[model samples]
Target: MLSYSEQEILAANVNPATGLATDYLNLFNEAIMLFEMGLDMPDMAEELADWHPRGYIEHFEKSGFELKDVVIAAYEHAPADIRGEFDAACERALTMFDTSIRVLMTANLEDPAAHADLSDRLRDMKGLVVEMDSHIHGRSPAQKSLQSEVDALF
Candidate 1:
């Protein structure tokens, strides 16, 4: 059971409904940004080499998020169904990022085919990010308002 109530978790900037913190999404965003940039500019490909996958917990622990401890605790206690689905999405995203990085390292970016391939990979990885974000949003029809309310507080 969660030691902190939903209200407390919400107050800490963690989503009480999904038991997730949005801060983790920034990690994925950074990877996506690198991929997008590299696809547009050949010289940016080196930036992808520096991108590494970081798990949700690792992100919070490494970041300066003030509520990292609370967010991590809430995530640990999140319902199994929600956590499982979220984890699956995250795993797919990580693999996609790794695959894209390999392509960047080996492929000739000047080839149109390579550009198309990377574009497709970026689209698919973005889809996974959306799936992962849905979990953070509670995947509920009613969550929009709740998230908005929570957002209003901070």
Candidate 2:
């Protein structure tokens, strides 16, 4: 089940010639959805396992829009009750995006140290996203203060 925002992004990303969402944002959206689904339902782990980190990094590089700005806009437009959750999710997503960029930038995937770093970052991102998903599924008082801080950042 894609979120409203994700659906909207996919819809907007459709290529007229292909009549399909083969654009960068759509790929990024799909990757994020896979991440969320994998977290909520372990049964989808096999599908999620096939996700490539470069797809999102390529989206970020090509979009010419900062992920934070997109997130802030999403938070601002979301309903009050869910704004906090959206904010937390956005923050985590941005971190994950940054980590993805690092992983892509590393030229030596065969190197033990580089591989370990990528693994650590991926694990950390998964944990952060899991926490974000919890907030998305349920309301939390802590999100209010965190949202306020996020507001101050922009």
lDDT of each: 0.77, 0.44
**Superposition error at 51 for model 2 (Å):** 12
Residue 50, candidate 2: how far off, in angstroms? 16
Predicted candidate 2 versus true structure: per-residue lDDT over 8-53, tens digit per residue: 5434442222222223334334555554444445455346445544
Candidate 1 per-residue lDDT over residues 66-107, each given as its tens digit? 778899999998888988888887888888888888887687
Q: Candidate 1, which segments miss by more than 4 Å at Cα?
A: 5-8, 140-154
Q: After superposition, how far is residue 123 of candidate 1 from its true place, in Å?
A: 0.5
Displacement of residue 125 (Cα, Å) in model 1 is: 1.1
Cα lDDT for residue 82, candidate 1 = 89
